[model samples]
Target chain A: MPAKKLNLRKRYGLLTRGMGWETTHQKMDDVFPYDSFEGIKITDWDKWEDPFRLTMDAYWKFQAEKEKKLYAVIDSFAQNNGQTNLADASYLSAIKLFITGVTPIEYAAHRGFAHLGRHFRGDGARIACQMQAIDELRHQQTQVHTISHYNKHFNGLHDPFHQFDRVWYLSVPKSFSEDALSSGPFEFITSISFAFEYVLTNLLFVPFMSGAAYNGDMATVTFGFSAQSDESRHMTLGLEIIKFMLEQHEDNLPIVQRWMDKHFWRAYRLLALVAAMQDYMLTNSPMSWKEAWDVYFVENGGALFEDLSRYGLKMPKYHELATAEADHISHQIWSVFCSLGNATGFHTFLPTEEKMAWLSEKYPDTFDQYYRPRFEYWHQQQKDGTFEFQKGLPQLCQVCQIPMVFTEVQTDPMQISYRVTEHGGDKYHFCSDGCKDIFEHEPEKYVQAWLPVHQIYQGNCGGPTLPEVLEWYKFTPEDIGNYIGSQDHARWQEWTGEDKEVKQA
Target chain B: MSDKKNTVFLILQDNDDARPIIESVEQDNPEATIQYQPGMVRMEAAGRLVVNRETVEENLGREWDVQELHLNLISLAGNVDEDDEKFELAWN
Candidate 1:
């Protein structure tokens, strides 16, 4: 008779455990110096649970299958001209935003997790991070490959990596990832794995994926399905890391709590871009931003925080503020993009009457009262041939680096909710108290931030003038401005055989 | 089952990959309430929820690793007890 096969538990243990040895040549402390500097006490590295029992062999097999399926679809999407089937060419603006702003973050995550995989003491955690590191790299590659077809038929996707580092608006996501990547291993995991992946991932991934599906972008939808499984593992790892830290030692509670508070706000603020994409960018909207937030964050995140309460962990600070801002952030972000249309890598347009009616239904209290009038006024301005983009750059928050566009949702929707602070006689501005609190905690770190607006003012960008700045950003005339008469708009109309009369009516 | 305080729940992305697991969950937990939302599904039970690997495999028509459930899992409430054969969630 053949010997009984090992079960997954025992198999995982044999594969991953007892891989590390006591070093007589080098002290374990010196080898893993980063584990202790953050003041997290780990009495036993053995207590670190392997969140998922995935071995390297199994991981390779699963990913290979997924890749096979994904590439097949992507090939077909290109062969069949999937771009023409989209709800509208205007939808590509959201995809351009995604590739420019979000895909680079996936690459950043790859680097970040690879760092964690090396620095952590526990074999379990090291293995998990190593797997996740590969997963992130895979996501980055798949995202690029999936969107490359769009790049063939569109503008604004030519120089994502170059633009990610230098563009003013891309700084929001760039700085957010850098903040996590530069932290200690524990804090990096806490900030990205726990706060962003576990607490706020659905807000980012679902909107883009579902938006893709709703708009007839089959290639993107397939990529989403492929990435979904890997995301689940990442999310599980996130939950495990937080629970592991909180349960390991009492001293870690407050430190973890503070990191959670800071990173949650950072992640939420970065998600404002996603909010605009969901609410306005998708031609056939799957759901409103408010609706997605309510379901994903309010209901799902509420359940997560409740379970976490057993470890004396509460919700991230100012979660209520996030809830309040949900009704307004999407509109605010869309308006900001519209105002800076000439400077943006993708086109921005006023929502059609049908979309405004949808927004009014989705946000009855806020939309009709505060945002619709501004859009209408802009539309009229465009019609009268006097439309103008905002020439001066907006003030950026020091901590999140988002332009100071958010308003005091609870008090007055018209008043921009700005906060101020001073360190060493240097004044810094913030979009909200959440950002102010983050900066106040680590004033030294935030002060060194290479703010885009400050850099542009100092003439570090291409030149002093707007045209030079656009040249520096690698923007062609086709890449920036309103969507109506842009090259993308023209091509899409040509492909669909819709004349000016049909499009206007 | 109606008492909110004692309930434990699991939310999964609604898709073809999760259909068999969802069916198995419904079969295993009779007291659970199932909800369908856009792109997701939620299952809530009064005090406990268990996902048996055997049942899922039966529904899937193949061997199913219990860990694969995480692929579709969005969120969950209650303490978790997971192993090779089964996954369970309940308040401690």
Candidate 2:
């Protein structure tokens, strides 16, 4: 018996060449037109032979066609005034979190892959980088476009890109992106593309997007899955590169391990947004963010890190810490939303009794006693027409990029809350010191966070008026103000014959 | 990518639901062995456990692609060792 020799390039070319990359949904048979990205070669695609080994023509055609079909759905939904069937008013909150947190990851991927486009010694790796670059851009754009649809229907969406710059809790995402963007190009690839996208992203995308499908937000669901299809390839590239590096030099082991350790923690913290959206916002069969993390981050990832220990790299230093925090983080974040909705660019409504029950079932430790009462008060206020948003901005955590809402983890799992520590003249608050240390690692990068409240205070936003501030944030009229009265809710009412606005108190 | 044999470690949920998947592997493939713990399954195979696409679909009684595997997975960690034809998932 002869051992088979591996040719990564040949395998890659088999997967991608001549696929009609240009036209969307022409046919599964159309190969990726090498001419699509001129002068870039996909043959080096062999760097990591995808076991599912999607051939080029089928790959491009399926992808382009999927995008095309998705776009058509978007068009029809918009044409017939389709935003309303979106199931519930609460769903938009999930979109708010997605726009604020996940979309930035696309841009971060763009920056990282762009570096891979430069660093890969082979044309194959470099070409994969090019495709990834385009994919990331489209992901970012599609997210923005899909989210912009809600702008006319909700708030908290004005200039999400800019909002990312200035929002308090948004610092969580902003800082994560900045961290990935700042790493050496290869490390960036491992952290964002491989570790974040390939390893953990499926947890967020596949399930959540499927949830979107069940809800009325077809556009969002479509785009999320479409982006994920591309992510499959990017994941391969990430896996290959890390593996290739390990193969190239034994010394690369420790270096790669260090990066793996650094990046896994960095990416995990950014996923806190998923914690909130999954557990709190989804209209149906909501998967608790904590459970999602256990499966996605802790179990899947923690297991992987243990395997890598043979290389002398243990699990990411913060893995346990991040895992330990998951069951509690979403409630902590939404706690801020409930308490601070007025000052926010988006709306936060009290969860229904049914939803509250679901949450209590999911978060047994804190919900019934700690968080639910607070939401109950907000519900009462809503009934009374006296609910007030947190009037001002929160101080942003320098490292995690979140607002200082996180609680300290006591020896007992029962109590979790926030801890603040001061560094120099600036006071740094964190969900925990793990986040604080992640920040202390590169305070220079994080110190410059653009907190939304800070911007409002600095008068850097449009003006003193919320609307004016929204405008400065690049949010349009439909993009700003109370979500209940926003366009999406209005459209939902019209479609369901329920009427759009909640009559003013 | 390391000179060392690539390994994949998976801890399955303790629920009784995944028994079929566990049983099928143990019975169908002599190479497949599963040790059950309090809340998880520790599966260690010397090399990749090949699941014919056809076989998986037949067993699951639905379209069972790689993505759908997430359903049965309690937790999985492994290196991707492969060529174009097959990718191996193994324990170190």
| Chain B TM-score in each of the candidates | 0.92, 0.58
Could you tell me how far off, in angstroms, the CA of residue B76 lies in candidate 2 after the best superposition?
9.6
> On residues A1-505, what C-alpha lDDT tens digit does candidate 2 reach at each position?
8877436446556444533133356632243322222122223333544433444444455557556756786777777656666667657777877887678768877877776665554455556776788789888988887777767765566666776776555666776777777766666777776678756786777557766776767788767766766775676567667666665556667767666766776677666667677766777644577776765666566555555555565666666777767767778777777676655555665567777888888888767877788779878887799977766666665566566666554464444446666666877666666666656766776677665666677887778887677566555665444567666566667657873433211
Off by over 4 Å in 1: A499-505, B1-17, B31-49, B67-81, B88-92
Per-prediction DockQ comes to: 0.32, 0.12
DockQ of 1: 0.32
| Location of the lowest summed lDDT over 10 successive residues in candidate 2 chain A | A33-42
Name the best candidate (by TM-score). Answer: 1
What local lDDT does model 1 show for residue A352?
83
**What TM-scores do the predictions have?**
0.94, 0.74
TM-score quality measure for candidate 2: 0.74
Interface C-alpha RMSD after superposing true interface residues, each candidate, one decimal: 3.8, 8.7
Q: Which candidate should be chosen as best, given lDDT against the real structure?
A: 1
Q: Write the per-residue lDDT of candidate 1 for residues A1-505, one digit (tens) a residue.
A: 9999788778778777757666789999998888899999988777777645777777787778778867998999999999898888888898999889988999999999998898899988899999999989998899999899999999998999999999999999999999999989999999888899878877777656767877788887777756766776787788888889988999999999999999999999999999999888888687789998987789778777877888888899999999999999999999999999999999998888888989999999999999999999998998999999998999999999999999999999999998999999999999999999999999999999999989989999999998899999999989999998898988988888873321210
